[model samples]
Structures are given as structure tokens and as C-alpha cells.
Target: MVSYAAENQLVHLLYARGYAVMRAPRSGRVGLPTPDLVAIRGKKVLVIECKSRKTGFTVEREQLEQLKEWKRRTGGAAYIAWKRTRLGLFLKLADVIKNKGNVGKKFAEEYGIKIKNEE
Candidate 1:
């Protein structure tokens, strides 16, 4: 399981950027597929799965597949935060995460989540 600290940091970054962020409910009763983090900005909704690097930058294939299915079903953006490195990475990822449509497309095609784009 990812640490609470990493999850908290991710939430903090999202919240600071005017996003309404929340942790995924663990009860599994919501029927709304619980993502690791949910951030909404205006009409855009982003669902993120966070992975801590306490072990390495690795994620289970099953989890990734599940997240992808959730994104497709919810019509929301889905992302994976590989490591809790710095606030900058969090901020960068948050930006991409907030763009649900584009991010969702990229995630579905690539099976990889990307951050930091050239400006």
C-alpha cells in the first residue's frame, strides 16, 4: 500500500491548484470505482493512482489495468504518480492529471502516465 504521507502530499498539491481533491473511498460500496485520488477542476474530473517509491518505481499490472477500466467507465482522467519526489513533480503531474480527456487518451494508448511537458 502507498503511504499516507505520499497520498497527503498529492492531495495537498491538487488542492493548492484550485482542484477539489479527495482520497478514494476504501469501502468498495460506492459503486463509483474508488480511484487513488479524485480531483475536479471546473468540469474536468481526474482520477489518479499513486505509487510510492519506498520500494521502487513499480506498479502492479492488475492495478493499472483496473484503473484504466475505471477511467474508461467514468469518462475521467486517470494517472499514476510513480514516486513522491518533490512538490514540483506533484504540481506538474497535477496539471496533466486535471486534463482528463487528453490524459485519459494518452494513458489508454501508452499504458504509461506522463508529466512535465515542454512549454
Candidate 2:
């Protein structure tokens, strides 16, 4: 399916986990680094940049930077959800990925949270 579909599904999963979520306005037209998803559960807040890549997931420097700025400004968390294979893997915005490299289970263990079982 398309990346937008992945984003929508991710939104639902976040809601199920008790985070109030909203899909940001389309970024290309908005001309801003708005994250794909914004979620808050009680005192916790997150800005998520979602990706659905066939190859390893890679985050744009600008995207990650903006997410970092958001977290810095809000004193909350920022994450990148690499929805590569329904694993629902996530990484901290500060985490490094060298040139399109995929995150390993260690990153998953540290930052990832499964939203759905493998399908």
C-alpha cells in the first residue's frame, strides 16, 4: 500500500494506545517541516515522521531536524516511525542512520514500540 495509507493506519494504532493524535496538514503544500503525526498521551507528547520504504528506511535531515526543533521547543519526544514491513519500528529523532541504513533490533529495543502483530 501507499505511504499515506501507512500513515493513516499508524494514526489508528496510536489512538488505540491512548494517544490523542492528528495527521498534520500536507507538508509539501504547507512549506513547513510538519510531522506526519502528532500524538499526546497525558504528559507525553510526540511528533512522528512516518515512512514506508521497500528498502531500508531513511529519514530526511530536514525532517529529523524539524522534529528535533519541535521536541526542543515543547520539551517532549520526537520519533520516526519506519513502517517498512508492518513491524512498526520507531527511532528517536536524534538517532543516526548512515545513508539510508535500516535500524536494527537494538534501536527497536531502545525506541520502538509494536503497534500491531506481524501480518
Candidate 3:
């Protein structure tokens, strides 16, 4: 099994920001297309796929498609949270899918969304 430390960190962050979050159980093994985390705060919704790596990371096209479908169905925002170090980078799914799922370190650092409260 893969470590979910990155996802847990993200959950805590979202929780601190007042979002009610749920982590999909057995995410990749569930046989259904689902993101790693779903967070909702009032009218806003966020579906996130989390990844942790020492360098860059790649998301499969199928996974990207799944996220797109989820966004379409839920009318929520989709994101990819890539954790390369202690603090992670958050990239909009729309932007990442345009690159065909390759999130290089440079691109991540340049384009990743920076939350105001992130330490």
C-alpha cells in the first residue's frame, strides 16, 4: 500500500480552512473513478488528487479523465496536490490536464496555487 501522509496533510490543511473533507477509501482500488479527496465549504467544492514524490510526478490520462468527469458531475473545482517536500504544490486540474498529466518540479513551482494560510 502507498503511504497517504501527503493526503493526510492536505486533509488537515483543508479542515483548518473550514472545509468538510472526505478521503475516498481504497481510492485506486475502488473500481470507480474517484479523486483522493473531496472537500466542501459552503458553496465551494474541491476534488483533489494527491501525489508525493522526491522530484516530478506523472498522472495517468485515465486518472485525469476521471477527475474531469467528477468535476463535470459535481460542478466542483479539481486539483492535483503534489508534495515534493514538506509543503506541497496545488495545481488546477484544468491547467495540468493541458500538459497531459506531467507535472515537472519547475512547472509545479511556477504554477502551483499558493494558499494564503499555508505555512
- Candidate with better TM-score, 2 vs 3: 3
Q: Candidate 1's residue-wise lDDT over 1-119, tens digit each?
A: 66678778768877877899988746544765467888989978787877664333434555556677777876777776645354223322334444432333334234443343232
What is the alpha-carbon lDDT for the whole of candidate 1? 0.59
Candidate 1: regions farther than 4 A off: 25-33, 85-119
- Tens digits of per-residue lDDT for model 3 on 1-119? 22487778788889998999999857356588888899999989999888878777788999899999999999999999887766577899988988889989778878897644454
- Model 2 residue 105 CA deviation (Å) reads 8.6
- TM-score for each prediction? 0.61, 0.76, 0.89
Candidates arranged by TM-score, highest first: 3, 2, 1
Q: What does candidate 2's lDDT look like per residue over 1-119, in tens digits? A: 23887888888878888899989857454776677788999989988877776554445666667887888876888877877664677676666443233455565566666657433
lDDT of 3: 0.84
Give every collision pair in model 2: none
Per-residue error (Å), model 3, residue 43: 1.1
- TM-score top scorer: 3
| TM-score for candidate 3 | 0.89
Model 2 TM-score, all chains together? 0.76
Point to the candidate with the largest lDDT: 3
